[model samples]
Target: MTRRRVLETAAFGAAALAGSRPAGAAQAPNVVFIMADDLGYADVAAYGRPDLATPHIDRIAARGIRFTQAYANSAVCSATRTALITGRYQYRLPVGLEEPVTTRFAGGLPAEHPTLPGLLRQAGYRTALVGKWHLGSVQDYGPLQRGYDAFWGFRGGTIDYFSHRGTDGKPDLWDGDLRIEEVGYATHLLGERAVRTIAASVKAGRPFFLSLHFNAPHWPWETPDDEAESRRIAGSNLRHFDGGTQATYRRIVAEMDTQIGRVLDALEANGVAEDTIVVFTSDNGGERFSDTWPFTGRKTELLEGGLRIPAIVAWPRRLKAGAISAQPMITMDWLPTLLSAAGAAPDPAYPSDGIDLLPILTGQAPERPRTFFWRYRANDQAAMRDGDLKYLKIRGETFLFDVVADPLERANLKARRPDDYARLRAAWDTWNATMLPERPDSFSETYTGGQLADHFGAGGAPTPPRPALAGEAPR
Candidate 1:
């Protein structure tokens, strides 16, 4: 048998040895999935960002398996989230094609679709989402309609950390679909709400699935003390193109880590730390100030940095402390992986493209090789990671690199290894054929004027007329 076949066989054998459920999982485990917005692969200290101190996020790495090769489904927010909640490729659904469900576009996660929290709730678990919900608006595609028993967060992509205003500078905070006004930094509020939800779940004697999606270190670059900065940027370009310094960025990330510490402490205080599965990762790669070392490209690109993310899984009952796995996994994998850990399965009608990772994570099976494909409407980017080799096509240019040996993706092995390149390219074409095609009017956020020059360098081509977000001030 080939090396890949041997590894697959061994993985299957290990799963068989571990039986149907993860060892030590006597009952359904509470799940706390923490997702950071625009966090780089090296954003966390454990992932190799020496400048920042993230002890709380580091604590999870110290206690469980750290995935060295994890990727987000898309390089953007809403698309990756679509794959995350559905356990399938984002391209499968119309909403997933948003690139990101930005303002002006009314794209939203369909309520009829089977979601992670929805399935878990059906399997006797209480589900709550206590952070950014970019899936859709509350009037139509709200989280409550998508399987979450309770939802307490904003419904847009970017919101002011202090004022809690959306991209359009309107109040976007919510309490189970009802618009409400509250005070404090968005990160702290979301974190504290998660703690309360966990406590409530424990008191009620039911397993809980808490999706804590934090919109930190993303844009406007406002720390908790930057409420004044929020006021300065309100009603203007919420993107804050000319704002944020590295020091301010550091403070933002540090504050997120602090809130994460609080959530960890809550689990321990509730005496369910051992019975809970905590996962920490990012929605996608970072932007301007993110430290995506040893990798090229940033958010909105099909490069390694744009797709790679830090993924840590902690379960005291099933995972060993300080363990590291170089398993190639993705955002959608969480749905099947967490569901398997909870003794639940994906809906048969909507089969998951991801595999259950509980067996491999618990050391019951060897890591198996997997192929992953990615595409972005911006820059006409398309990429595929098959084994160690990666095929990339962007701006109508094609290149190949062995991402394993060259994580930076500097070498072009296309001519040297023409066969592998052709193979992967063909594979990507086949996979892409199965998924929905890109629409003619699909929205992709492109740079303009000086920003275009800043992103694409001098003499860059001008972009098409972009749709103005509702209530956004004209430049």
Candidate 2:
């Protein structure tokens, strides 16, 4: 495929200072990484949303640091998860190139790839995942084989919040590859599981790393009591084509917040609160029924709304309360930050494309400017943000914006900053050259090449039957 055709397609935190545990805190801290699915940047109360309140998510920011410019490595699910798992740019791996991992895809995160959980486990920490595990569900590539000591969640992108079944019509909920049945809302169930795990780990006296990835406010957008909506989607596309309202979105986020609070309450009740590093962030930006204020674009686009996300790091022992940092953090940054906090290093062969944020978080260092790059297969979307300026291209049209000044991305500065635009565009080209090429194996054989090409839509937006989501946007 030519570079032109490639354009169309597609497309966490915290804690401080190297081993400087607060006087009364444990030397080896527990890490709780909570990631929300398809959540908008301004959706959380702390971020700028007046329409909703996410107090639990807010506490992390109010008590610790709220990152103003946090970002996901990829605008889509599986890809961001890839970067989070490996602490490297998602583009460095073939798995990251997949817009989102489709159920029909043959390959998954290779079992042997160095992962955040794997490294923590190697350093004598107990690791667990208690929510969506979209990496893959194949026997060898599942979380159990990927270094998580325990796994209890679905292995697909989105599932019916009530039925807990994926679009494939299979029981996606699993406990170490064994299908399991459970009642109640998935968000509630996963929260309870995480709390239990935290209590169990404390009782076992092992430092733990728990990834509480929520599929809330994703698709089939149901609040805890939306059983009728669940039934409504039972026979249709599990994406929930018939439902969702702003009010429903409010309740969905509220439910997620309440569940997250339950888990945080577990941390405090178990007496591990101060000795644990809790991080709350999104896997990517929000989608339909989301309010991405002060930013443009949604999940599928490489605009600020799709990439910038709400992030907070509450390491009570190592970080001061109510701190805010304008760090240009990325999803991959968590791997190094958490690893550094754990006093571990990634496997030498698989070095990180991210930097550790402990120094900046702990006030030991100053924040410096850096250029961040993004590319999605759809619309030929590519962007480069350096300091205040950004160079963007969508469907072959290139433009420049002083993003810091124009957060809405309304201005087209290509003419005035031609030199800067060319420079940054070239910078993206140079960086893109160092990454892995898109892999045919990364796509599902279930899809025809022409269909995939059409989805890439070189001519324009793909034709009808297009679900509300194409980069899936949790669409």
Candidate 3:
């Protein structure tokens, strides 16, 4: 599976990508993909956050292509991360099967499986992850062992912003594998590390791929100035439902935006800003005070709101600035897109479930007819989108909607378009049959009042009573 053969097998082929590059685009570009945990489609200013300010996150959109119909592979964290790195549907791997991999989940992303970082690193690129590694917490399944050359961040889903501790109340911050206590907000720390990495990579003369997964605007939300809140929740669990407010959420997002600007500035400072492929998006939709305007659902549910994400790719040398595309793109698509951009390709022996979006992103190609399928919680939820039609099944009821026209998903077109509904439904069934079967863990759940958390994984640890916040999306 030589690189040459991979390019030859690529649908874009080597010549197409070669033409897509700017003059002297022969050298592979550095990649900086920043993922915000649980940030929603409308959370950022570019996506219409009038009450909040996110200039830095919006800058990527201003400078490059903004994807209107972009989606994460899954509606949850670990699942989408798995798909992003593997270029495959998350359910194909056991780690992806978990809604959100935690300390309780023993299975991990096997090292043998090919990864976006692993492939790039093999192609002489430096790789580092400077934020949350929620894939798996155990030593056997850490990020470094999988693909990244270095990892500096927490290893679980949710963490205390000020104290940098997981729900287990232990120090979750780390540099590589060792626990290093840094006295600062976790988001700020992650941004600083990423900025430093960018400069170091520039000095080393190697193309770098940095995955800055910020665990901000999530639960137990605290901004850079909230040290007192950390001490207040010292005795109780780390996830305090009473902590976050719209004002606090604004500050938290602002802090994240400020750090992102710093990192982007670092790229310019290193003289690689134009050559770097900078991508920014959320791992999933927003929750608890998130502005998912014009769309309804939130993370943890298989709905348009939970799946829709705001995405921007900024590579000034290759992509046009301020371009907008409504073509549907998913998290897995990054694996192939970036790989092709770097003149690297997946191993010929193993292929990818995601399509190469480079041609479409660069305006070299038009939107192609494609269908995407999703299944979660033992088939309790299923969704598929083909062209302009979408078929969905959640909570024991089926639905059909034209997502292009009805982004809110308020209209169920099953009766109006039965043929399209049947077509998409059959499409989902056939697609689901190709992936790995859902693990029993997804189906097994314990109720907590009006909310239900930890839909999967071996979560034996006692969790705080999850009070359904009435209007918040399904937990």
- Predicted structure with the largest TM-score when compared to the true one: 1
Model 3, C-alpha of 38: deviation from truth (Å) = 0.3
User: Compared with the true structure, what per-residue lDDT tens digits does model 2 show for residues 1-475?
Assistant: 2243223210101122223334555558899999999899999999888989888888888778999989888778888999999988888777777778776655678766899998887666777899988876547578877877788889888788888888765667887677889998998899899989999988866688999999987988788778987887785547654577899999988999998899889989999899899999998888767777899877767888888898999999899899988888899999999999888777889998889899999989999887788877655578888988888887678889987789999999989878998898899899989988655334311122253332343326222112323333221
In model 2, what is the error at residue 49, expressed in angstroms?
Answer: 0.9
Q: Comparing candidate 1 with candidate 3, which one achieves the higher TM-score?
A: 1
Question: What is the total number of backbone clashes in candidate 3?
Answer: 0
Using lDDT, give the best candidate's number.
1
Clash-forming residue pairs, model 1: none
Error of 2 at 46 (Å): 0.4
Model 3 misplaced regions, further than 4 Å: 1-25, 443-475
lDDT for model 2: 0.80
Q: Would you list the clashing residue pairs of candidate 3? A: none
Q: Candidate 1 — which residues are off by over 4 angstroms?
A: 1-25, 452-454, 457-475
How many clashes (backbone atoms < 3 Å, residues ≥3 apart in a chain or on different chains) does model 1 have? Answer: 0
| TM-score, every prediction | 0.91, 0.88, 0.88
Which parts of model 2 are misplaced by more than 4 Å? 1-26, 439-475
Worst 10 residues of 1 by lDDT: 457-466
Q: How high is the lDDT of residue 201 in model 1? A: 81
